[model samples]
Target: MGFPDDTPPGLAGVLATLRGDVEPSSLWATLVDLAIRGVASVHCCKGALLSGGKEYLLRWNESSSLAPWEQEAIALLEGKRKGTEREVSLLSLFQTLAFGSKGYRKALEGSLEGAGLWSRERESQRKRVLLISLLLLFLGLAAFVVGLIGADAWLGLPGARAAVAALLAGAGVGAMVLFLPYLLVGALSSSLTDQGYRRGLQWRAAAKALKEELKGEGFNVERWGGDRFPAYSIALNLTDAFQEAVKKGKITAAPPWFSTALADKAEVVQFGALIALMTASSTGSAAGVGGGGCSAAGGGSGGAG
Candidate 1:
């Protein structure tokens, strides 16, 4: 049957039929009837059989490396005793089953395993990047404070030594007030993202879980191995929606810290520069006032003497 790609092929088709807008569960009984009629493959102890009578031949044109159990099942199904009912275990079926060819199972497992390992490595790299960013932020604050205090002495502030201590103390408080929340947010978010990919799931399950965990809300479960697959290459991108939501919440809770720190430092520098300019202006004003007073006093003395 040439079922449209948009619709689910097997079990998926059953869902599509049931969800017609005009009818709720209208196809429910029909779906069940089809299932009972043996349109679906039934699991026997050793393998899945295309039920509904006579022995059907399944061609195995796959490469070598068929698991031992898979080879045995294929042989049993192909042998002269094919039609006879035989008991098979569920564990044996999956462990030994080949869907179409040996390559299908190998390809699927190989892709999933490779993507899983890559996700782990990607997370480790993100942690390293975030840690480095935070460390640099702290270092920048320290450098700014030191520069401010050092400038104070060169600018000839009263009790220059004391000013440096006061500036350092204030800068420490300011940096803490600005940075603590951002650091906490990044740490928490990174932790959550890291944990999300620690176990590999189909992209759809990961997306659904991520949405639920972060937003506590609705998200569609995607069908994996289809078009529009989530980027498994980057774990960070995989959970980006969740990460973005958390980041927004963090920013709302506390303004951007590193930027705040730099802003505060800029304000302090501006205030210092203003004060320096004012001091120079005031000295000139005092000299002018003193000179005028002295000239007036001398003129009066000369007239009196």
Candidate 2:
């Protein structure tokens, strides 16, 4: 409920993605948050989706443990309706999980709006941009046409036609400037409301704190809520923090929720590397699902893009 506590960072990634400034990695973050809440589990397994390397086993703690958008993501998983406990694979995630499920994005955005983080009338911005561009184009063309028809026909000056040509050219250039760039793209779209803007300033400071707390020197993983950090770190685009912590011996063991098949068990970094690999490899896929980029809210309070 507060900024960057332990719950997958409050869907911060979703906010920035909808703002169109970044892609999202909220799916992974959300899963980790769910796991923290004792709703899911993920561990390295022995098979691959298409390649011949390792994959992960994802288990649902309960049949109805997911959020509505989360539900939409794995809605069609092979065994969702079988029983209280269910299992799926990371390989299957490629086929499942729409990073940008419109429903999911909309729902979170709506919640943020309700919480006064941003505005909800975003569709209107797109419409307004398109309408204004079209209007400007029509007006410019109409003026150019009328001007040409009503102009003095070089009766006294041979240069009159040339002058008219220059006017038409100028009008064309003006129209193109107004209609060809960002206006036609995502014109008038705004992600921050006044309250959101105030909150944004706080989020920046929070992000800096994240770097220090998670990756800074001599940081103790156990004292830092290690279990939540590994996954949430990735969601927040601080995979380095997780990796660095492991490399420097700050993290020697993984939290219980993250495990491997080997009896001796993989090193923390190995498991982390696999997590990073799977997430990066699936970046393209997350974008297809509607995730904008690597981002997440703080442990609870703020967001990062």
Pairs clashing within candidate 1: 45-88, 45-89, 46-88
Candidate 1 lDDT, 1-305, residue by residue in tens: 11123311121211222211111111111111222222211111111233211111112222254433233333533342223332222222222222222432233223333433223344455466568658756865785677566765546556666566566657666765676666665554321123223332233344455545445433322332121211110111232442343344421221111011123234323222222222222223211101011111111111111
Please state the error at residue 229 of candidate 1 in Å.
Answer: 29
C-alpha lDDT (0 to 100) for residue 155 of candidate 1: 64
lDDT of 2 at 301: 12
Per-residue lDDT over 269-299 for candidate 2, one digit per residue giving the tens place of the 0 to 100 score: 5567755754564365321111111111111
Best by lDDT: 2
Q: Candidate 1, residue 158: CA error in Å?
A: 4.5
How many clashes in each candidate? 3, 22
- In Å, residue 19's CA in model 2 sits off its true spot by 2.4
User: Candidate 1 at residue 226, lDDT?
Assistant: 25
Reference-based TM-score, model 1:
0.21
Measured against the true structure, the TM-scores of the candidates, in listed sequence, are 0.21, 0.65
